[model samples]
Target: MRRYCLAAFLLLVLAAPAHAQAPAASLPKVAVFDFELFDTSLQGETDGPRTDEHDRLLRAGDQIRKGLAESGRYAIVDIAPVNAAAHEKNLQACGGCDVQLAQQLGADLAVTGVVQKVSNLILNMNIYMRNARTGHIVASMSADLRGNTDESWTRTASWLLRNRLLAPDFGRPQ
Candidate 1:
């Protein structure tokens, strides 16, 4: 009886690790593209694009990629292969082309974002994730940032990632 008990205990211990690894191994592969900015602010129209906002766009993309990867829910595939196409085309306005590019990268989901600036004080930041094969949006989140400063945008990205972006069953179809 003691030997049988020991055997069962070992089996349970070994099974625990295997079960734990299963979910992580099966996490969806996602390709996160660079974020784009649509500036409609007076500063942009008259004075032309601000260099600072361009840097912000780069940071926003990095933040999203890191957040998703650390969530243990997605495997972030590198989007470098399609970087040119991503930069040249407005992924949001291209009518499912983002999905096609992501699919070519062997990704299960395609992710992109945009920051629309109405002025120095008003901005809308949005992130989108779509099924690469189906070309259907599975998850999306947006934040309205009041200040155009880097701190506000960074904090908003962090908040959105923590609260809505990776929430329970965030993208899974109900």
Candidate 2:
């Protein structure tokens, strides 16, 4: 009986390591949309959007997509197929239109963000993730930026993803 018990214990121990090393289950797919700008400052009011604002918006969306993909947190569904269709309306104002589009792309969640400019000197960047089926927000994060320069915008986006949005405790209500 003792010999039999010892043999079983050894086999269990050997199998445990293999199980632990198995590849992780695939992550949920998400559709990440382009970031939009909401300009509230007087300059934005008078001059319309800055000439380079469109470029900035594209970069912001790319940053979030790259961060999420590199972190292995989500399987990003390519938005290129539906990018033009999405641009037909503003996702920010469409009231869950983003979720519907994500569903059409076979995604489980939809991601969106906006950069709100109070002035050239003050801005806030925010990102939101919503369940495609439920259309409920799953997680969101924001960061305040002091400069409108490219470096500031890029760094803030990265920081928000690395420290807040992607943090282990993120998405849990306080």
Candidate 3:
């Protein structure tokens, strides 16, 4: 018993400073890209009805971006400037859109997503965050938002932020 207790105390004493000296982690700066719209085509047969679905997805993406940016953890840059700039550079999609361009415009991370239907009225999203300089996907998430309304938008945004940006391990040591 005495040997065990002494060993435990010595271990704790040695580990304390390492724990206390660990530097606080900083939140990575993120820029959100306009979400890709899939399942939202106003086709020959699905034209009229698809308009509502398309609009809902567009709004949801906007709301999610806004909510995530409100956290102040990310240096959120609007997609308008990025898109206009990308057009000038002849980049196709935002993800394939150049990281060097993004970094030169000042962003550490670039976030992009897609809003599509996984089921009836269930909007599913696949979001990705890439390290701008390295082009590595640092984080990714999938979520199902079942309806298109203010409430649904709010819920989806909250879930996205919690799971992707503010995850418990987000600021933790690897």
Alpha-carbon local distance difference test for all models: 0.87, 0.85, 0.62
**Clash pairs detected, candidate 2:** none
Candidate 1: worst-modelled 10 consecutive residues by lDDT: 16-25
Best model number under lDDT:
1
Which residue pairs does candidate 3 place in steric collision?
none
Residues 101-152, candidate 1: write the lDDT tens digits: 9988999889889999999999999999898889888988899999999998
Q: Per-residue error at 123 for model 1, in Å?
A: 0.5
Superposition error at 76 for model 2 (Å) = 0.7
The C-alpha TM-scores of every prediction are 0.86, 0.82, 0.62
Task: Judging by TM-score against the true structure, name the best candidate.
Answer: 1
**Which scores better on lDDT, 2 or 3?**
2
Candidate 3 stretches with Cα past 4 Å from truth are: 1-27, 40-45, 48-51, 85-95, 98-101, 148-150, 171-174
How far residue 18's Cα lies from its native spot in candidate 1, in Å, is 4.5
- Runs in model 2 lying further than 4 Å from the true structure: 1-25, 169-174
Model 1 misplaced regions, further than 4 Å: 1-25
Error of 1 at 145 (Å): 0.3
What is candidate 3's TM-score against the reference? Answer: 0.62
RMSD of 3: 10.1
